[model samples]
Every structure is written in C-alpha cells, then in structure tokens.
Target: MNQPKKMALIAANLAFFIIVGFFVYQRFGIYLNNPWTRDGQVRAQVIQVTPRVSGTVIEIAVVDNQHVKAGDLLFTIDASTYEVSVQQAIANLERERVSSKGAKIEYERLKDIAAKDAGAVSDKDMIRREVNYQQSLSRITVAEQNLIAAKLQLEYTHVYASVDGYVSNINFQIGSQAIANQPILALVDEHSFWVFGYFQESQLNKIGMGNAAVVTLMGYPDTPIEGRVESMGWGIAPADGTVGYNLLPSIKPVFQWIRLAQRMPVRIELEAIPDNINLRFGMSASVLILSEEDSP
Candidate 1:
C-alpha cells in the first residue's frame, strides 16, 4: 500500500464514523422525545361488596371470579331476624294508627262540644285534648319511620351486585358471619377499565386529552388495544415535601448533579375492548400516543 492510498483509507473511515455518529444522535433524540411510556398499568373501579345488615350468610349466589351483572344476587344473609323486625315494626305502626284514630275522634268530639257551648268544655280540657292528638300524630310518624327502616334492613339481607364486574377476593361463604359495612368481596368493574400511563413530565407537551393511543398489555402483547387520552392527573404525592413527625415540612436532600423528570399519570380511555382479550385490574401495560399520521 502506498502513502496516498493509506491517507485515502483514513479519510473514508473518518467519514463513516461521522455518519454513524450523526444517525445515532438522531435516534437517541427520537427515543427521548417519543410520546410513549412502558410504565403503565391497567386500572378499573373496584366496588367493595359490603352488606348493610349483618347476619350469617345463608346462600352464596356467585362464586369467586364469577362474572356478574348489575343487580345480580351475590349472596344472601339470614333474614329471620330482619323479618321479625319488620313484623314488629308493622305491629307498632298499627297500634300507633289505632291510638291516633282514637285521639283524633276524642279531640273532634271535644272541639264540637266547645263550639256548641263555651261552658260545656273547659279551655284547659280542650287544650289537653289537642295536645293528645298532636302527640298521637307524632307517634304515628315515628312508627312509620320505624317501619321504613325495618324494611330497609330486610332489603339489605339480600346482597346484590352494584355494577357489571367480576367478583374477586371473596372470603365469605355459606354460614359465614358477615358484619355490617364490612367488605366481603370486591367487584372489579369491567366497563370502567382504563389504562394509566406514567410518562415523563417533559414529554407531556406532546400528549393532549383525546389524543389517540395504542396499548399493549403484558398478557396480550400481540393484540394492540386502541384508546384515547382521557385526562392528565393533576397531582401526585410529593416525595420530599411531607410533614415530619416534628411537624415541619421535610424537604429531602437532592443531588445537584443528577435530576430526574417527574412522572405524570395520563388516563387512557379504551375504545373497544376485544371480547377475546380479558382485562384484569392492575395488569402491566405499555402505551404509546400515536402521531396524527399513525392514528387510524
């Protein structure tokens, strides 16, 4: 090889290196500015199933992981006690009604006698009769309220699904004692399912509400789910500025050399979820906001 040939070879290698470096820089910039995030999770509204009235579980209408519709029976509590309460309420209401009727009749008679002759009924006696009638009316109202409450308690004995969802975390079975307002199971709402994507705050400018997105679930990687950006989360728990036990705002020390961009959750509303693909709450997902040209 001659000296000129060696110089020519060096020049060629230099040009190749420069071109490669330029392409690499462009690719890195694209990766950084891309409106996408691997830090996304499938989310849904979880309905905690709790009974308003407590009793022994008599029957379990649905099993664990069962799909149920709104108003479907989930389980039944022993309603014997509630039924007795209803009967007692009804009897009390009847007694109050009878007493109120008698008081009304007596008050009317007293008023009529007083009207015929002022001296026939004493003012004190007439006032007393009116008081009695008012008290009876008040008692009747109380009894009616008690009856409604009893009926409400009876209705609580039959637990029903509040939303269309899959039953999860079912711990109570037949014969298990359920406490009032205590959660026995959770229903993950199917229709309320959405993906929460945490993107770098710096990349949020490219993401707008209603922007089309493509989601790939970890479970169903081959099937891309279509969605739209619903909204951006306005707030997140602060990592550094929390109140300390000493009652002062605790600001965490930061390293001046390295700064990390905060992640903001972007809500993605799924378009048409495929029937074949099942979406589970808290499932891992990857989401990408499509550029206008890429969106179908």
Candidate 2:
C-alpha cells in the first residue's frame, strides 16, 4: 500500500472510534444518572420522650433499646408531690362544695323571707347574700378545675409510650431528676419507617409520586425492601446562603464555571417490613426506581 493511503486509513479508523466513544459516553451518562442513587437513608419520626411533670425518677420500667407498644409504661416519676397536690386539691374542692351548699341555703332562706315579708330582707342584704352564693359557686368551679389539673399532673408521673417503637438510649436512671418538658430519652417510631433518597434535580423528571422503588440497606444488601414514593421535599437550605453569627445572610462565592445540579429528597414509604429485618433511623440505604413495565 502507498504511505499516503495508509495514513488516510489510520485517520478514518481514529475518527470512527472517537465518534463511537462520544455516543457511548452520552448513553452511559444517561444510564448512570436516571434511576438510582446511593445517597439514601432509612429514616423515621423520632419521638423525644420528655417528662411533663418534674420529679425524681423512682422506677425505670423499660431499659434502652426495648421495644414498647403505645401506652406501655416507660418510667415512673416520684408521685409523692403530685399525690399531695391531688389530695390538697380534693380537700379544697370538698371544702368549697360544703361552703357552696351552705351559701345556697342562706340565699334561699333570704329569698323566702323577702318573698313572704317584703320588708324583712333588705335589698342590699339580699344582693350581698346572692353575691356570696355566686362567689362560692365560682370558688367551687375553680377548685374543680384545680382538682382535675392535679389529677392530670399525678398521672403524668407515670410516663407511657406515646407510640409503638424501640426506645433509644435512656439518659436518665432511677433517682435521676427529670425536669418537666425536658427530653430524657428518644423513641424511634417503628411503624413510621421510611427511606429518603436524594436525587439530582435533573433526574426528577424520571421519578414521580407513587412510583415503585426498591431500597437495599447497606447492612442487608441481599434483601430489597419495596416502597412507593410518598412525596418530594418542597425545599432545601441554599448552600450559598448560610447564616452568620450576626444573623445576616452570608452569601458565599460560587465557582461560575461549573454548576452542579442540586439533589432533592424524595420520601419513600416502605411497605410491610419483614419480621426478620429491623429498620432503624439513619441506616444507609440505596434506592432504585423501577420502571412501570418492570414493576410487579
């Protein structure tokens, strides 16, 4: 072959390979970005167990990591103070009731006397008796409310599980002072298990709500959990617009040359979880969306 002919053939082959490679790269990129992401995590609603009434924890019923049903006793606070308050409230209510009864009798007596002999009960005196009776009624109402509140407080001493869940680490122990409204433990909601997938915004067109998805946990790669897209997050914190200590929006400089697509979180509600598998919050997960034809 002539040298010029050989050089032309070499250039043709190189051009053909380049063309093929370019198309392959584009196809590969599409495949890589469309349907799956490793940036996912098993998440659930965590209930922060805060005490409603403050007192020393006299008894701890369940240990950390123990699974409990709704209404299960968690721990008991010292009910001595709450009990005393309840007794005092009861006593106050009883006293108020007796006083109210006596006032009503006195008012009725005055009313009867005024009806029989118009001059017997003066208008001012009748008014005073009626006012006293009404005041007694008001006091009784107040006492009744106080009694209810005290009973509620006494009941609050025995904290119970608000949801069926596995208890997280309990920071407080027996004899620990649990302050009112202070979170001492956390409960990982068992039934609220869901997976959150962070997908690139550009890839969202391929995903939709109610779309079937498969989640493979990092710990249990062999078992895939089935789920459906529940919802998409409405917003995220802007990376460039971070707040400073001065309470001002501190905009950061961005690299103008390359703009990466931001990832949006999609919530996936897991179907019935297998008994063998225990889903916990913040577990690493990989999510893949199934095509309509591929879904069962």
Candidate 3:
C-alpha cells in the first residue's frame, strides 16, 4: 500500500480498538479495586489523669503498658501537707463555732439584765451584740468551706483510673508536680475496633451495606479475616478533608490527562476476631468483595 493508504489503515485499526475497549470497560472493567481492611489496633480512650489541685507526686504505683481496672489507685501525692492544712482549717472552724456560742450566751445574759432593769444596757449595746453574733456565724460558714477544701485536697492526693483498660505512657513520676488539666496517661480499650476503607464513587453501586468482605491482612499472612460492609458514608471526603491536608495534584499537564476518581471512606466491622490472633491497627490489608460478579 502507498503511504496514505497505510496511514488510513492504521487509523481504522486504532478506532476499532478504542471502540472495543470502551465497550468492554463499560460492561466488565473494575472501576475501583481499592481493597480496604478492618484489623485496626484495639483503641483505648486516652484519659487525662491529672490532679484536681496542683501537688507534688509522692508515689507512682503503676508503670507503662500496665493493665488496670476502673477505680484502681494509680498513684498518690504527698498528703502530709494537705493533712496539716485540714487540721488548721478544722481548728479555725471550731474557733468560729466557740466564738459564736460565747457571743450567744453573752447576748442572752445582757437581754435578761435589761428586761429586769437592773443594768443600763443601751439600744446600741443590743445592736452591737446582735451584730457580733451574725459576724461569728458568717465566720463559721467561711471556716466550713476551708475545711471542705482542705479535705478535698487531701483526697486528691490519690489518683485512680476512670475505666478498665491498659495503662499507656505515664507522663508524671515521683516528685513531679502535676497541675490541673495536665495529661497523666491514656487507657486503650481492647474489646474491638472498626476499619475505615476508602472506596471510589463509581463502586458505590456494587459494594454496599451488609455485603460480605474478605480482608487479607499481613499479620496472619494467608489467614483471611472475614467481615462485612457495615455502611457507606452519605458524604464525600473533601479535596481538603476534615484534616487540613489534601492529596497532591496529578503530574500531567492541565488538559492531557483524565481526572482521577474520588474515594469515599466505608466502615467495615469485623464479624469476629480470634482473641489469640495478633492483628493490629494501621496494618495494610487487601479487601475484596466476596462476590463472583459485582452486584449492588
């Protein structure tokens, strides 16, 4: 064939291949294979265990990675200073009560004398006595508050776990002064975890809620972790997601390349996790729908 005829033939063949490829892609091509996994680290609640009041840590009973129950004593702050404060507050409270009692007795005696007309107790004197009694009562209230604060400070010397879980990294040690709102440690819950899988928008019709999933994790190697798709998200993960970061732009020039499909996260819940297995969080896994043909 001449050059023009050869060129025409090549063009025709290219068109034919393109049409065939498009038809096949429309019918059977896997638009999204984004295999997802669910074997994540058993998450524990990171509890900020800090003193209600600032104090020196006198004793630390627990270490890192230690298992503890709810209400278990984690450590103790020195209570001697707090105990002294309590004693001083109690003394002040008692002094106020005694003074109020003395005032009451004196006022009662003066009133009796004035009524009998045996003593010249002026109206001003009576007012003074009443005022003194009220003042004493107010002092007693203040003393009571001081005593309560002292006792509460004393109780704060001891720290306890709020929930049952593993003891993570402990931040404070003996002699370390912990202020209010400071983080002491964390507690990881071991009961279970949920997997976050990112799927393309086009795959939404095939993989859906309650669809069976096969998770092939690295920990077990050949052992497959069976699970099911719990649910799909109603919203799309933004180009800039909940986090401040977004995926970098593609390397192609402005118009030459096709736009990549966006992926939405799907939550996969494990049907059952064998207790003896050592599956962990952040471990990469290949996910596949347990379907012969992709169906809704």
Residue pairs in candidate 3 whose N, alpha carbon or C atoms collide under 3 angstroms: 40-281, 41-281, 44-188, 44-189
Error of 3 at 169 (Å): 1.5
Compute the lDDT for candidate 3.
0.72
lDDT of 3 by residue, 52-157 (tens): 8677888888898787888889888778888999999999999999999999998888899899895589888988998998899999999999999999989988
Error of 1 at 169 (Å): 0.3
Question: Residue 150 lDDT in model 3?
Answer: 93
Return the lDDT, model 2, position 72: 98
TM-score-best of 1 and 3: 1
Model 3, C-alpha of 168: deviation from truth (Å):
1.1
Worst 10 residues of 3 by lDDT: 36-45
Query: Per-residue lDDT for 221 in model 1?
Result: 90
CA-only RMSD, every prediction: 6.9, 8.3, 12.4
Model 3, residue 170: distance off in Å is 2.6
- Please identify model 3 stretches exceeding 4 Å from their true place: 1-42, 113-128, 191-193, 198-273, 277-296
RMSD (CA, Å), candidate 3 to true, equals 12.4
Model 2 quality (TM-score):
0.84
Show where candidate 1 strays beyond 4 Å: 1-33, 241-253
Writing each residue's lDDT as its tens digit, candidate 2 over 1-296 gives 99999999999999999999999996576446448899999889999999999999999999889999999999999999999999999999999999999999999999999999999989999999999999999999999999999999999999999999999988778889999998999998888989999988988898978889989999898998999989999898887657886988787766899788899999998997777788888999999886675566
Instruction: Give the winner by TM-score.
Output: 2
